[model samples]
Target: MVNIIAVDDSALNGSSTGRIHFLLADFEFTGADALHNSRMTFFFSEEQSNSCNKRGVNPMEPACPRVMISGRVKKLDTTSPEYEDNMEAFNNRHKHFKIWVQAHHFYLNELEIENIFIVAYQGGPRTIDAEDYYNAQL
Candidate 1:
């Protein structure tokens, strides 16, 4: 039998904020170490809320999540013959079944995140109250 699994926020916590959520869909695992050389894609979802947006609860447009290539790795002794300084070989030293999220934030069991790019959102602040109309009326 093929058992499929879905990684959702239910496995994480609702109180967490300021971090993107990633879901590891499908694929059944008998053990945490069973995943090896498996390529997976994670999607990031943004939330619009009074605390998140702080712009009068208006929904915000969703941004596309970036994809990163990573896989399981096995620990190696630096003195081993398989060890190399090459980029490709250097990345293949670790082994485990774990989903990565953005850096600087602790990821819960339900949340899996991967960092791709650093984006700076630059713009004037927004307000929900009517300003132009109030000024004109006065």
Candidate 2:
């Protein structure tokens, strides 16, 4: 389970995109090791409905944007089709995470979100770049 500790949306004042950084805890560990807390930041942009018009898509509606997740990702067996499925599922989870945050955070809920991007760091923000916490996507 994850718990949101804080959020900062001050970037919205200058751009169409902004970021929300939150702390996550209460991890359910399954292996022999355990983790402390994680700090995740979500970067998102508003929907651009006009972009579809240039592509000649019907109705000129905006296409479904994809969420890009970077850092601490699990290694997949590229030879199997399951890799693709796993990626798709991961993307969906990111979407849900974004929605959940927006629902709970008033400032985020007020934005016209379209694309959600996530970057995670395993340790505290100050030590995120340490050797012990190499970035990956999971």
Candidate 3:
């Protein structure tokens, strides 16, 4: 099964109420930028793994399906004074996000397998601006 985790910031799509799938893949970050926000972080836990497995997606396919993860910050602005005061907390969160991404890579690596492809691009290149999403979180 495809092991996946999703984190979203907007709770739901721009139109939907509660939580929806649209916000889950709205932006993408690369290089050192993904570590920018501590509050905007996501990690894969046992529960997350089980959830993805339940979806019955294959992880070893030549074009493995992509899983988008996004998360929200308590506040939208990352440079607010409050965020500055909690820089330590922010760093911790960022580190956790990083760990999840790394863990996924490591797990796939240990399998010594190929074909479980992960597209590292972001911003929904395949879709319109309004439908775009970040791919770095997954």
Candidate 4:
């Protein structure tokens, strides 16, 4: 499945159309000069690498499918009850996330706690984004 995550999408795209763009700037943090930050940082969890090992696959080795987070919000689509329930489960971690993001070392300031959503794929670590949410509390 192709997953898309739009960052401060308004910067890349003129409007809040919620479209995904995969350019270096869209994912990189150059410095403080750029006021535009998607903040939708992407990464393959340690578990992902372990699973790829079982399949005789090098997670980031050559020939592997591009590892990416690209997709629009699923809010518009009526997902199965199972999916809906799982997504709602994020509320449980809201407190912890809010705490960690505030801690000095690791910072993802662009995220709005109430607006986060998890995108699961390949039966592994789920991608996350706070943009393009439905009925967001933010």
* Candidate closest to the true structure, highest lDDT: 4
- Candidate 3 lDDT over 1-138, as tens digits, reads 122333222211222111211111113342123236322322223333554356553443323234333343222234555433233332333446446434443111001111122332343323212123322233
Candidate 2 residue-wise lDDT at 41: 27
Q: What TM-score should be assigned to candidate 2?
A: 0.21
Query: Residue 20's C-alpha lDDT in candidate 1?
Result: 24
Query: What lDDT does the true structure give each of the candidates?
Result: 0.27, 0.31, 0.29, 0.33
Return whichever of 3 and 4 wins on TM-score.
Answer: 4
lDDT of 1 at 126: 27
TM-score of each model, in listed order = 0.21, 0.21, 0.22, 0.27
Predicted structure with the largest TM-score when compared to the true one: 4
Candidate 4 deviation (Cα RMSD): 14.2
lDDT string for model 2 (1-138, tens) is 322233332332232123232222223231111133222323222223444355564331224232332232122344666444433343343545555434543111111223334322222222232232223342
Residue 85 alpha-carbon offset, candidate 1, angstroms:
40
- The digit string of per-residue lDDT tens for model 4 on 1-138 reads 123322332322233423222222213343221235333434333344476567676655432333344222222122545333322233232334434323423222222223322323355543345353533452
- The residue pairs in collision within model 2 are 71-136, 71-137, 72-136, 72-137, 72-138, 73-136, 73-137, 73-138
* lDDT of predicted model 1: 0.27
